[model samples]
Target: LAKTTQPISMDSYEGQEVNITCSHNNIATNDYITWYQQFPSQGPRFIIQGYKTKVTNEVASLFIPADRKSSTLSLPRVSLSDTAVYYCLVGDALANQAGTALIFGKGTTLSVSS
Candidate 1:
């Protein structure tokens, strides 16, 4: 499995945009970069994903560099309610693979203030 590294925390005011970057230098060719957002006690929610270039949705945008070693999640006009932990996952796209369970570590915590 590829190892991911992200920031421990970030601060943003309401209506401001926030961007979190994560690094996975040893990502496999078949793996994809996925981002998840988690509130205090709830499970993480899927944010965005990308193989290369860029992928965007209503929630956020994912930017992948040419080397595919790192990715970024950009949230637009965040609110106080957006305070949460952000996670970056780099793994096989197949759901039924030998190692399917996503291994998590300390994630980046975003603090949205008014």
Candidate 2:
């Protein structure tokens, strides 16, 4: 697994668009960028994932540059309920061969206010 770099914390208001960037300078060719959100005392949930281009879902969008060294998770019209710890993970797509356990780095704490 590759290490990621992201902001320690962020502040936003309701109905605002939030973009959190994660950098993985040593990303491997077989690795994919995945984003997860974790609330207090809860497990992390998958948000979005991408390899080289843009991947969008109902909840958010993932943008990956050509170099694949970094990625950004974009959340639209976020509300107070959206506040959580966002993690950017890099790993292989194959579940069994990926690893024994999922490892996460210090995530970005997003605080959405009114």
Candidate 3:
């Protein structure tokens, strides 16, 4: 398993941008970071992946440095409803059709307010 680290919590206001950073010190070269958002009593929803320099989706944008040791999840214009627990999981990016093992961190709780 990879050694991952993240903040315990974060605070943001409505319509503001929020960025959560995760660090994976033992990440492999082929490993990519996948961000997930989980609301209370809900399952995790995929945000984006940082396989290369960056990856973006409708939900969020992920940025990865060249060393692939860490990733940042950026959420633009967040609202109160956007408050949730975010997770970063690292896994093999080349294992397209194979079952890959993911290394999960504790998670970061994001609090959004109006």
Candidate 4:
């Protein structure tokens, strides 16, 4: 597991694009970058995941550089309803070591307003 560093908060208006970047300088080669979004009183939802290069889905896009030391999550045309806390996680699923659980850090809060 590698530690992630992200902003504490961010502000955006409706229909705006928001990009939240996370840094994992000590990331291992086996680790993959995963992003999750959580709204108030709800469990975190998986947004996207990637190893290297770009990966996009209906909800968001993940961009990882060649070094794989960092990743950026892009949310296009966000709306007020898109406001939530975003988490960036790194782990190796194949490791299968004991006590291997998803470790969560203080996520970046995105505030989408009108």
Per-residue lDDT tens digits for candidate 4, residues 1-114, read 788999999999999999999999999989999999999999999889999999999999999999999999999999998999999999996687675688899999999999
Q: TM-score for every candidate vs. truth? A: 0.93, 0.93, 0.89, 0.95
Comparing 2 with 3 on TM-score, the higher-scoring candidate is 2
How high is the lDDT of residue 85 in model 4?
98
lDDT of 3 by residue, 1-114 (tens): 567788989999999999999998898777778888889999888778767798888888888888888889999999999999999888776776776655557799999988
Model 1 TM-score on a 0 to 1 scale: 0.93
How do these models rank on TM-score, best leading? 4, 2, 1, 3
Residue pairs in clash, model 2: none
Q: Which candidate leads in lDDT?
A: 4
Local distance difference test, per candidate? 0.89, 0.92, 0.85, 0.94
lDDT of 3 at 63: 89
Candidate 2 stretches with Cα past 4 Å from truth are: 98-100
The segments of candidate 4 whose C-alpha lies over 4 angstroms from its true place after superposition are: 97-100
Show the lowest summed lDDT stretch of 10 residues, model 4. Answer: 93-102
Ranking by lDDT: 4, 2, 1, 3
Could you give me the TM-score of model 3 versus the true structure?
Answer: 0.89
Residue 14, model 4: Cα distance from true site in angstroms: 0.6
